[model samples]
Target: MHRFANPTRFLRLAAAVLPFSAAVAALCLGAGLVWGLFFAPPDYQQGDTVRIMFIHVPSAMMAMGVYAGMAISSAIALIWRHAIADLIAKASAPIGATFTFICLLTGSLWGKPMWGTWWVWDARLTSMLIMLFIYLGYMALWQAFDDQTKAARAAAILALVGAINLPVIKFSVEWWNTLHQPASLITMEGPKIHESLLWPLLLMIVGFGAYYLTVLIFRVRAEIHQRRTRMLRMAQADRHNAMQAAD
Candidate 1:
């Protein structure tokens, strides 16, 4: 972790691996979608509509996973003052929000066929909606401040607080009387889902994870460049002021 504290080193590493991650993400995501949509057997009860699960489940996993990552990054930023950590946390907001949105959208599409409604206030769904709002709020909090340090602190605090929702989202189906289905792929008793369906779903989740990493590296590099440009401008302004004073 400390090895990546140097932005230049991180940028070089990111550049080297960016293409590979991007390619893997695309290949896996495409193959998973094709396998899941075209080749996999349909659920006995849900029929072909069960195909939505391939996209919906992975997006839901990524939505929560990304927030967990943000909380970890924020913790590092606050405790260790790692500059890159703050940039990572900041860069993750939009991507996480996008995943959260995709989860909600795909879930809605799935629900309409399964639940006979376009939306529901089911515990899992409600908790996930709250998470979406949390992501948006964290991003808004960052923009609310003029000082980057203060913004980082505020956003990090929000991220830490909002992380409580992750558990709620995960357990909502079990803890409450909800329409949402409980975990089928992961269990103490082993996966209940058939191997035919499970493998493609796993592939999609891995693809999504890879996609997030690829985007994260690129966004962090952009943040570093933006910060450097800002610093350079400040320095130039300071020099001009000093020269005017000398005159």
Candidate 2:
């Protein structure tokens, strides 16, 4: 961990792994889409409409996963004062927010046909909505500060506290009288899905995870560059002022 504390070293490592992450993401998404759209049998109830779950479910899974990643990174940044960890938490906010939005939008589309309504006050849905707001609030906190260091610290604290929603999203159906279905893939009674469908769902999930990694690396790289550029500009300005003083 300490070995790669230097951003330059981390960038080199990231460069090596970036292409592989993209490749795996492409491979997994391609296979998942093919299997989900054609190879996997249609649902007995919803028929073709059920196919949307292949994308929606995985995005929903990733939404929560990204938040959890941010929360952990936030904790690490607070305790260990790791710059990369803070960068990760900051860089991932918009992506996770986008994914959460997709989950809600797609879920609503799916629910319309199945539940005969576009909106619900269900526990899971409400919690997911709250997740989105929390993400926005975190981002706002970061940008509202003139001091970047203070912004990072404040956002990290918000992220750690917002983590309480993860469990609520997970166990929502079990805990409340809600219209949302309980866990299908991961449960104490084992998966309720068929193996043929399960494989594609897993593939889509892995693809989503890989895609997240790829995007995160890109965002972090850009952020590091921006910081470097800012530092360089500051140094140049300082040097110019020093030269003028000597004159």
Residues 46-68, candidate 2, lDDT per residue (tens digit)?
Answer: 77777778888888888889998
Q: What TM-score would you give candidate 1 relative to the actual structure?
A: 0.88
The digit string of per-residue lDDT tens for model 1 on 44-146 reads 7778887888888888889888998999999999999888889999999999999999988987887787777888665556667888988999999999998
Q: Clashing residue pairs, candidate 2?
A: none
Model 2 global lDDT (CA atoms, 0 to 1): 0.83
lDDT of residue 224 for candidate 1: 88
Residue 45 lDDT in model 1?
71
By summed lDDT, which 10 consecutive residues of candidate 1 come out lowest? 182-191
State each candidate's clash count: 0, 0
lDDT of 2 at 46: 72
